[model samples]
Target: MRENTEVVVVGGGYAGVMAADRLTQRDDVTVTLINPRPAFVHRVRLHQMVAGTHTAVVGYQEVLAEGVRLVTDTVTRIDAGGRAVELASGGAVRYDYLVYAVGSGSADPQVPGAAEFAYPIAGLEEAQRLLPVLAAASASAPVTVVGAGPTGIETAAELAEQGRRVTLVCGGVLGPYLHRRGRRSVAGRLAALRVTVLEGAEAKVTAVTRDAVRLADGRELPSAVTIWTAGFGVPDLARRSGLSTDALGRLLTDETLTSVDDDRVVAAGDSAAPSGLPLRMSCQMAMPLGARAADTVLSRLAGERPEPLNQSFGAQCLSLGRGSGVFQFGNRSDVAVWFHVAGRLGAKMKETVCKGIVKHLADEAQKPGGYSLHRMKGGAGRREALEAVRAEAPAIERIS
Candidate 1:
């Protein structure tokens, strides 16, 4: 009889959950998933959680496969040499393979007073913490949302729709990832909601005070509540565990998602930086990456070589409010094009996408190894981009 292979997946977000479920394809493999939260967090709808529209959480039982064991605990470190992970509570869990998917969280603003005063809505806890702060503030309070990314735009629009005064301080151009046409559509929506859009270099926030925010152009805006959605930062678990990582602290891996230091260890989601070229941190890439990571493990267990990553994207969707949205069409390379869907249709499409994501997870739970979106072709652009980087520094060492 073949021995049972033990696989431990750290983190319970989209990537971790998907990997754990897919790993159950082989009956001889026993999968265990470790996460800090008891339930699955719908990270894409975090802004909705802050705006009091959705709970942004689902019971793990609803999405995780029955064959997988869920451990509600935090992983403190990964002992690659011993093939075990140290838990925060106590003891350790041994594994034949480890999947590192401890995804991202709110980045340190680094600006003076920003961390102390601004509220970030990147994770479940962070979004939950902002709920009461928003509820306590007066309806007429001037809420300032820093950053022009999707999170900031969504939060600003959601709050503005609630009749609260909103000021969006874009450190750079508004909707930097969107085409000019899409940006115009978003600008129109924000204007209709009475949100004050501040862009350009002068709009950059320099400091945050209890009652106001200072800008780079020596202007001060009265802000009763400040929300920061600038950028995301992954946990330093990889670096702390003595594992090699990229500059942003993400576990660096080869094209097959295998750690350069140990073939038994793999990475996925926002915490993974494959070939030093990480994909954008979003649910768009996390689920596919999760499936790919599981495939790598299965291939190794079957004594076969694994394939490299080949993920593609379609569009970037953003909800302006409960009734308005914009879907910016992008090429396979994820670069925005001139085509877009705006207004009510865009809103419906955005809603469908959010619902589809949950459905995809639930469907994969029922049928292991059935997910195939990650297998789509069109990685030529990615290969070219990686080759360019490789040519620039031929001697750069691979890290994991």
Candidate 2:
């Protein structure tokens, strides 16, 4: 292995940050992380921020590991032959190893009038812009949610709690991801909050004016505010460069997270769809996937074949309201495990999950070589005790 290896990771989300941080631990590799924004948007907290529950605009420099170079720019092109990343600012970045962690976003944008009128709860910028719009609008204003997925349900419940007349228009089965009882439980919660759940409503939102949603059903709902949270499509860079991509533009990867076209390039987070086991785009997947990507890269550098990714996680955590939530335990394949939780306990658990994410990033910085879990300083710079181990201990295996 050369000491001057240059690794450029594209994407500032969880996967990119974790890969860059882990790589920087080794003195030999020069890591450059490129993204469009300087701040790592904590998407899980967007809904809370929109509801005025929390406010901590996390900056990249704060979470990024020391000695790692960060470049803020959108990647426009990828020249694999030359190993050069063409940036939007008419510049180029070369890489010995490339980690494609650019995640997914709102899948379809061509929905008629949806972009112009509907608000999305994806990231900080959108949520910040949406807060004032909701606060100033009438408390009794009719709010129509376009999906009944996890995000749509959470948003609808939150809005309903805020005393807005919420009507959730689900095109198909409502809460199909949840168990039958779990689904009905959530429906009951929505009803308690005065949220009208409309299932099997084929709502082709033809036009979304400032006042209402013009549906193809000829039933014009007086939706003073429309929230569209459905259909997330991965970034198009994989297919744009002619790399083998799925129908949704997700780069087809092997079980080891290696791109099908090029073994040297690894894809993670939402942009990756390993052929055998496809993982969804959520905090649950992104967190572990980032660590797995790090493990694969580091193992390859250490002359060891990384284990195939068999990480199975489908526990969908959804925040219902300020102090209410539903914890649906699902098997690896997204089948519910027959246990659930609601109310304050569920909310506390969700809060702990958010805090743990931040803690993991902080823990990564204090560990040497980012190879294994060693004794590291906790939050507030508190020293942690370490256990003595052999020099040839396995610290970087099965990153979990």
Alpha-carbon TM-score of each model against the true structure: 0.98, 0.87
Per-model lDDT: 0.92, 0.74
Candidate 1: clashing pairs of residues? none
Taking the tens digit of each residue's C-alpha lDDT, what string does model 2 give over 1-92? Answer: 56787888999887777778877767888889999988888777776677677673677766788778999999988888788899999989
lDDT of 1 by residue, 1-400 (tens): 9999999999999999999999999999999999998999999898888888999999998899999999999999999999999999999999999999999999999999999999989989888888888899999989999999999999999889989899999989999999999999999999999999999999999999988999999999999999999999999999999987999999988888888778899999999998888998989999999999999999999988798888898889999989999999998888899999999999999999999988888889999888899998754678898889888975233222
Residue 342 local lDDT, model 1: 98
